[model samples]
Target: MQVISITDLNSVVNPTRLAVPIDTEQQHFQLAMKQTCMKLPTEPLLDAHPQIDRWIMEVGLLFPKVFEWEPPQFLVDTQFIAKLCTKKKDTCVQINTNAVFHRNGYVNLIEWAIRHPVLNWSDKVKLWVATEYLSLPPENLKLTILALHPTHPGKRYEISWDSQQHEETRNWLVSVVTKQATPMKTPVASQVKSPFPVTTGADFDIGKIEEIEI
Candidate 1:
């Protein structure tokens, strides 16, 4: 995977189209799924707390439809509605309704998303969490996870300006952002902070990952 920047994201993504209005069928599906999950007692559902709220759950249900992807079937065993928000059988995209307040909190959420069995622990996947307020024409900074590997999911994904793979990564991100429809705001470099100092002598840990500002 190539490194992706917020500027790169802005050039490709149209904010107005980030999130399409939730349709009636999706609303009905979300309600039905919520009712079904509420009845089943499962550990995954409990473990996915705070992360498994009403709005995010609704986004999870509508994600496939918005992206024009196949909807995942509800599994009774997992008992978590989000477990069914898979994109391509392996890619699990979790939408966040709440902003991650601190660096540790942000890291923890990514770790949880990466390790959760609902996601199948897939390393090839990118977990895009829409950490923006759920109002019409969203008006706050958004948090997006661009890392390639999940083993160290908290690490930043930096775009190497001179690399051959830059365009490849750029195109991939463009495809994703255009399809997802979650608006992204311009990031203030001064305000964005990485929790830990980047490791030296390696390209992977060079640039800082963009932080979510509330």
Candidate 2:
């Protein structure tokens, strides 16, 4: 929804405010620096899909991310922003180049998919629901991404990534979803309670978000 240029980033991102000093945590800090430094030209925000709930259910059954796994951090680097909560609140996914930022004393996932450059509308909704509602870990989220295959007769689905283990992936999904005692809520204006604490690995001290103002 917003467009920020690479040249303007210096004013927006204050390098000295980084939570992880460059010397001690080289890899993560460098990643954070690189993301901030290589700011994308535009940030795209998707409107809520009418069939988001149904697609969420489908992704839960399919393992799409296995085919193309882009973790949360990767999403951040690509400048994906999922809008959630009320527009009046301006609440959406927050991040610095380094990590997810906590807002209003809590990290929330609402209905909208935050910005990412590449995901299709369907994949965008799946990531939003999985991160905000289902609280699925990256590994589990991958499989959930694939269940929304096109409806065609005689369509086949892989149960596992491993050629030798036919049902391994399917069986693992069964265990994971089964553990959730609560049902997921439909995407709506109101917040849905998650069954577990949601933490994207991108989460770190809020101050670390100085690199890119979400």
- Highest TM-score, which number? 2
lDDT of 2 by residue, 72-124 (tens): 42333333343343322322332222122233222222111111212232232
Question: What's the TM-score of every candidate structure?
Answer: 0.20, 0.20
Best model number under lDDT: 1
The TM-score of predicted model 1 comes to 0.20
Stretch of 10 with least lDDT, candidate 1? 75-84
lDDT of 1 by residue, 89-134 (tens): 3222333221222333231122112111222111111222222111
Instruction: Please identify model 1 stretches exceeding 4 Å from their true place.
Output: 1-19, 40-214
RMSD of each: 18.7, 20.6
Report, for every candidate in turn, its global Cα lDDT versus the true structure: 0.28, 0.28
Model 2, position 148, has a per-residue lDDT of: 25
